[model samples]
Target: MKKVLVVILVAFIILQFFPIDKTNPAPTPGMDFLTIKKTPPETAEMIRTSCYDCHSNETAYPWYSNFAPASWFLKNHINEGRKHLNFSTFATYEPKRQLHKLEECIEMVGKKEMPLESYFVGHQDAKLTDEQRKLLIDYFKREKAETERKMSF
Candidate 1:
């Protein structure tokens, strides 16, 4: 037991040397989601607090993210999240994909599947109230309508 504990402690210490880079480049105003779509202030704030870490280029990494295995997990999760939805590059998505993504966003939030369960544990602030969830659902509804309207032209 003592030898096992000692080995674990040593491994933990050694793993700390390999840290993942979670740093994001400075945000440009033109590259923001609000710049492309009309995001109400409150809704925008909610998205920033709850969704941006994984869904955008900006990820506010926590202290534990510096630990080796944890850092790797964080990096992979962020990468996968970005692949699914990158709001930082929202304007670049083709219209069809954009529309589909918006629909998925609404569905995810309505089901409370977003800000994934693992994320909310560490980030209490990311937890949304019922009102916030409604606001997000309404916002997406409006956006989807607007997108469809434009496509009909």
Candidate 2:
């Protein structure tokens, strides 16, 4: 038992050396979803607080992100999120893609699949209330409709 404990401690210490990269891509305000869509302040703040950490280029790594194994998991999750929908570069997506992304947003939020449960473990502030969830779903639905309408023209 003592030997096992010591090994675990040593492994943890070694893992600390392999810190995750915390660099965020440079901000592109002109291409950002919030800016281009002219999202209301309240809605924009909610989106930023609840989604931007993983979904946008403005990731603000928490203190624990300096640690290793957990940091690795976090980095991978963030990369996947950005790949699926990078609001920071939303304006660059073609109109069809933009509409699809907005549809995905509505579906995800409406189904309560977003703001992943594990995320609230570290960021309680990101947790959405029932009202907030409804607000976000409504906002996404509106955005999707607007995108579709514009594409028709």
Highest lDDT: which candidate?
2
Q: What local lDDT does model 2 show for residue 23?
A: 88
Model 2 Cα lDDT, one tens digit per residue, 23-99? 89999999999999999999999999999999999999988898889899999999999999999999999999998
Instruction: Provide C-alpha RMSD values for all models, in order.
Output: 1.4, 0.8
Q: Which stretches of model 2 miss by more than 4 angstroms?
A: none
Model 1 superposed RMSD (Cα): 1.4
Clashes of 1: 0
The lDDT for every candidate, in the order shown, is 0.88, 0.94
